[model samples]
Target chain A: MSALIDLFSVAAIGAGLFFFFAGTVGLLRFPDSLTRLHALSKADNLGLGLVVLGLIPRAENPLAALKLLVVWALVLLSGASTAQLIGRALRRGRK
Target chain B: MSVLPALDVGLALLVVGVAAWTIAARNLFASVVGYVAYGLLLALVWVRLYAPDVALTEAAVGGGVTGVLLVTAGKRLDALASAEVGVPPGRALKILAGALAALVAGALAWVVLTLPSPAPSLAPAAAEAAAGPGAGLGNPITAVLISYRSFDTMLEKVVLILAVLGVWSVGADAAWGAAPAPLRKVRPDGAMILLAQFLAPVGLLIGVHIFWVGADAPGGAFQGGALLAAMGMVAMMARLAEPPRIDSRKLRLALVAGPAVFLIVGVAGLALADNLFAYPQNFAKPLILFIEAFMVLSIAVALPMLVCGPPNGSPK
Candidate 1:
């Protein structure tokens, strides 16, 4: 049972690492600010969510797992809003 | 080659890399973003050092609140389209400054590497206070802040109040009592407003939970109050709420309440206990918690005021 859980954790965390790597590449390679923001928001948000989920089963307690979830949620909220705000500013600047 | 050690080595390298990027990034906004990343990375360093309380503060205040403050300043500067005004430094001066900075960094690194074994720390003293008569607080950081060194913490609160006043002093005489300009964007996006509306209540709850749990856990007044302040700034930015008026009595009261209560308790302690800041044996825990409650409120108010600065031309 423990071995199975460990394998699951590794797979989930590995997927998260992949998204993070993808996000960085997209950030550097994307042609424009809006597209870059899109890449970052999507990749980073899902990456963090998966990482948090993978760690939950390893948490010492249920509350600790929930706290991890809350951290991811807060980051998600902030990242989404930040990307939108920047996108709006970008369009306005060109106008 | 344990996983933990490898993670720590990678984190240290990442922190150094980001710190260098923060200083070297060509654009102001990029530099500020790098700084935010650096702050977050430093929080991880703090965690690795077995200082979760410090980690929370580093992440919330160092990274989160400071990031918002700088981004706001960057936006305002971008608006003015200000030309680069400073004289370009000659190569000789730049080299001298770089060499000096490198020397200082090397010295700091050497000190860390050669530190006395076992770290000659005050941990034992802090541990005694944590478990002893100093409020029976489980978290040593809170015990030291609220019980052992309450005076220093009280003074820190006063410093925050002074900062608020200093910002207020810079406003034009006619702008007193006026609301600061709205923090909204040129054309606020609908999605952000929805996010703020959903996030603010949840953030506020977590903020209070952090404050409440500080007595027993890694969270504390500073971390919780910063979260509260972050929520307020978000709501203001989303155009969901107006900034409080400068001359409002309630605003002034909340601003001073933390330090004021802390001071009152310290004065009362002289008569009620062995010395100033000493809570009578049975009442220690309750008194400390009472003071912390007010400190959180005051911190929540003071940080937003600092971020917002003083009142603008008219009430919004």
Candidate 2:
């Protein structure tokens, strides 16, 4: 049972790491502001979520596990909204 | 060799790389962003050193709040900078400055590498008071702040309040009671407004929780109060709320409340406990908690006000 959980955790963490790598690649290669923002927001959110999920089982208590989820959720909310705001700013600057 | 040491080496390298980039970045805004990244990396370094309380402080004030301040200042200065005369320094001067900077960096690295092994630690003293005293706090840092070295903490609060006063006085005489300009962008930003509303409640709760848990954990008034101040800044930036006028009675009261309460408690200590800031053994925990709660309130208000700068002058 513990081996299975460990395997799952590693897979989740690996996938999350890949997402971060992809996000960095996109940030460098993306042609424009909006696309770059899109790449980062989407990739980083999923990356953070997976990382949080992977680590949750390792938490000493249920509250600690729950707090991990809250951190991910908060990041998602802030990231999406910030991307939107940045996109708007980019538009205005171009105009 | 364990993975941890390797990770630490990588982290240190990353921090140094970012610091170099931040210094070298040509654009002011880009440099500020790089500096923010540097601060975040430094926070990780602090965490790895088994100082999560310091890490929290670094991330909140050093990275988050300072990032906002620098970026905002950079934006305001951009237009002025572009209009000013441009003068490029000779290569000889640049080379000389670079040599001096390298010398300083080398000296710092040498100091860190040669730090005495079996580090001179005050852990024994800190832990003895924290555990032996009936303070009953789990965090040694909190015990040090409020129980052992509390007068220093009170005086630091005084310094913060004085700094805020200095910032306020920079405004023109006619603008004393006027509200400072808000941090919002030119457009009516719907996304920012929605974000502020969504995050502010959660952030405020977390801030309070950080303060509450601080008695036993890594979180504390400084970290939690910074979070609250950030929430306030987010609200102001989204145009959801205006900066309060500098002369508001209630605002001034809140600003002074922490230090005042702390000072009063200290004086009372002089009479009751025979020394300033020394609480009665039985009542120490509650008194510390009471002091901390007010400290959070004052810090949360004062920091954001400091970041907002002063009210706009009549004719700048």
Give the candidate number with the greatest TM-score: 2
Candidate 1 residue runs with Cα over 4 Å from true position: B78-83, B89-121, B185-187, B314-316
Put down candidate 1 lDDT per residue, A1-95, tens digits, no spaces.
Answer: 99999998999988888898899899999999998998899787999888887898899999899889888987888898788778888998999
How far residue B153's Cα lies from its native spot in candidate 2, in Å, is 1.4
Candidate 2 per-residue C-alpha lDDT over A18-70 given as tens digits, one digit per residue, 9 for 90 to 100 = 99989989999999988889889868799988888899888999999999999
lDDT of 2 by residue, B102-126 (tens): 9998999998898899778777786
Local accuracy by lDDT, each model: 0.87, 0.87
Q: Candidate 2 chain A: worst 10 consecutive residues by lDDT?
A: A35-44
The CAPRI category of model 2 is high
TM-score of 1: 0.89
Per-candidate total of colliding backbone pairs: 0, 0
Pick by DockQ: which candidate is best?
2
Provide the TM-score of chain B versus the true chain B for each model in turn.
0.91, 0.89
Give the TM-score of each candidate: 0.89, 0.91
In the predicted model 2, the residue pairs found to clash are: none
TM-scores of chain A, one for each prediction: 0.97, 0.95
Chain B global fold similarity (TM-score) for predicted model 2 against the true chain B: 0.89
